[model samples]
Target chain A: MDLAEVKRIGALARLDLGEEETAAMSDQLTRILDYVAQLEALDTTGVEPTTHPVTLGEAFRDDAVRPSLPTEAALANAPATDGASFIVPRIL
Target chain B: MAADSDLARLTLHEARDRVTAGEVTSAELTEACVARIEEVEGSVHAFAHRTTDEALAQAAARDAARPDPLPPLWGLPIAVKDNICTQGLPTTCGSKLLANFRPVYDSFVARRLEEAGAVILGKANMDEFAMGSSCENSALGPTHNPHDLERVPGGSSGGSAAAVAADECLAALGSDTGGSIRQPACFCGVVGLKPTYGRVSRNGLVAFASSLDQIGPLTKDARDAALLLGVIAGHDPDDSTSACQPVPNYEAALEAEVAGLTIGIPKEYFGGGLDPAVEEAVRAAIATYESLGATTVEVSLPHTEQAVATYYLVATAEASSNLGRFDGIRYGVRQEGKDLLDVYKRTREEGFGAEVKRRIMLGTFALSAGYYDAYYGKAMAVRTLIRNDFDAAFGQCDLLLTPTAPTPPFRLGEKLDDPLTMYLSDIFTIAVSLAGLPAVSFPTGTTAAGLPLGAQLIGRHFDEARLLAMVHAFEATGQGRPLPAL
Candidate 1:
């Protein structure tokens, strides 16, 4: 929960942080983790992790091609989109 | 015998009956809600987006086609939480990131409501990305409690609850990940039901924690809650997690008696951190239930202390994964940067608020290499134990009764600076969400300050019918549905 740790986690989460934010996050994350550290007191041995409360068997859809959103609708919310394609910063 | 002009005061069930009997037109009902919203929107700040024209048009259409058998929600003007997608309307989710983003299609819940002939009043404000306990986390602005203007309406569904309490709409939809709907309903003096997970489809809800988030109703009373739940609950092919079980007639289930029911009071919920007034009010509610011939017993949930920690881990981990879609590529606001990586980092950094960033960072750290087992994995295991605790308690009783929140609504910005203190606001309501059980928060009494106090009734999974029945029976005692003096 140090400044370096905060910065590393922020970067890993795809967020850019200022120096002050990083420092504040370090303290806050440390406190939260310290609180969370209480979980270590419990013995969770031989317990199965519950990912989702409702247990559903495998579901398969009919794999039918249905009507989808038109291209205009699909690109309606895009920040930067050509008529038929999205525009982004160059990769290489 | 409320007049057409006083349609806002009618419960969803009453309004539906009147509309079916031709006593009032949907246009008049929509006008009443619109006028109410116009009168109070300045103080309450409940709605993020108001759709007056669309609502009126929908109402006019409903009036034109007076079908033989009316739809369940016919002519009711209901507000939707901003996180649930609505076609052709801005679904901001109370964040700058999606400030003007309108979806191309309606969410499953919205579509069902529309098919049932409900008038879409507007989108209600909420915590940014449904993340905080108080509505103060909303980037647009915080919503004020209808009971007291200075105090906050609890969140992240604060606006929905406030609107229902203030009579801006007949009822509203709210998504609960961790007490978002129930706590706000408790604060605003309304009935909020969080149906069992997978009981309602989540096809288009903006995911915070997918497993824990279920859309439910915030209404003036328990019967209204049942009516709205019936309209929205059921399986959806679009949502794979939706249960394929037959949907029950929840409104009909409300007529059943609760004479022989056994309600458990979890001892842990009454301990430290509980305000005396809130505890006393909830205890009085339990006594009323006892007088109605329902038995009460003390139960234990030993892992209660670990729920907040486990919820944070599991919810944040899922949020981090789900929110990665908002990288400025497909939709939402984008900030141009030097490179693609820079675009993502800059967009997210500028778009998300502090609380969201803190959660994303925490999730990233927990799920990162070498730390997953110690943090996220352990949290999942502890979650099992927490669910087991509820199962064991329910085995002893039919329902668990407790205070919805540990305290009454505080002043705005009271706990905004301290994140841990804010997280503790969901202390009593989080375990039920983790267990994916059905629960409702109904008003028990008002505090000396006149703010509402609520008691929660938790039932076994998929047993919402019984829970609604118990709440309806309690409502018949004249203690439920206290309207704020707005």
Candidate 2:
């Protein structure tokens, strides 16, 4: 809940937090964590975590080549797209 | 027998019947709804985008194709939640990030509704990324309650509920992840149904918590909800979790008798946090059920108190992972930066609202290396116990009845500043979502202030038909309320 802790978490989440926003978040996260800390009192011995409500095995598609969204449609919503590909800042 | 001004007030089933019988044309219904929207949208602020020309054109197409056997929802104008993608309309999800983004493909629910001959009206407003309890979290601005402009319409599907309550649209599609649909319906005094997990396909819904989110209808009555659910529910190969179970004739199911049914009144739901008036109204609703020959029994969901904390942990953890896809590289608005990492950070910071950012940070903290087991891992285990609570309770009752929310809708901005207080509003409705059960919120009565109070009916998984039937019977008792004065 400290400023440094907020900064670390923001970095991990890839969010750029303002100083004011970070201060507010630190206080709020602390309050929320304290509230949720009640769960620590419960005994969850040997209980399986439920990732999802229903159990389903891996989904397999037909493996047939089907028509996909045309390149233009795929890139239609991109903010900066060259005609053929999304234009992102240099990664290297 | 009613004037065009009253056409917008007709339930979805009524409109469908009139259109199918040729007594009224889709153009007339569409024009009536358009006029209603025009009259109220300024105050209600329910829509993020309106599709007048497209709706009229679609209505015209339906009129021209009066096939021998008409579709179930022929010519009915329905609203879609902004979070659900529409092929040509802007699907903002009530965030600055996707404010101007339009999907190239319709979501599975939208596609199904279109194929069922429903005329798409527009996208209704919701909380940003369906993250908050009140519609106040919408980046566009909050949607006000139709009953009183000063009060908030409960959200993240607030606009959908408010629009239905105001008669701006016959019914609307809303997504519920931890009570988004039901809470708003309670506040707005309408019928909201969250079907079982995988009851409706989620292929086009903007993911919040992938496991908990489901598309549902906020309607004027249970019959309309059943009609809309029938049109939208079925197996979709596109959604891996969409169940392959045979879709029941929900409209037909509404005719079933309520006698000899066992209804459970959960002791936990009526405890300390519940408002006295809401408790009275909901208990009266149970009395009405009892008068109709239904048996009532007390049941306990011991883990009910932990639902909010558990929901935040599980939902935010999923949200953190799901929202990671919104980085500046692929879609929506992006802020340019010197480097890719800067682009990601700046775009997210600029695009997401405070609540969204708070959740992302909380989720990140939960899923962080040292804290994962204590928060996210423990929450998942608690979620299992919560689900098991419902399973055991259902063994004794056909349906579980409770108040939809702790209190009636409060004034706008009342709880906006405090996120925890806002989260507490959905305490009654969140557990059903966590258990992946189907539940409906219907107006049972109104508070002294004239705002509506709703009662919830939670059913076994995939038991929406039974839930709708019970609601229909309750509606048949001459207790179903009408639209609020705007």
Indicate the docking level reached by candidate 1. Answer: high
Please state the error at residue A49 of candidate 1 in Å: 0.5
lDDT (Cα atoms) of all candidates against the true structure: 0.92, 0.92
Q: Per-residue CA lDDT of candidate 2, range B315-345, in tens?
A: 9999999999999777888998989999999
Q: Residue B332: error of model 2 in Å?
A: 0.8
Candidate 2, residue B156: the lDDT equals 93
DockQ for every prediction shown:
0.87, 0.81
Top candidate by DockQ: 1
**Candidate 1 off by > 4 Å:** B1-5
- Candidate 2: true interface contacts recovered: 0.78
RMSD of each: 1.1, 1.0
Q: Where does candidate 2 clash, by residue pair?
A: none
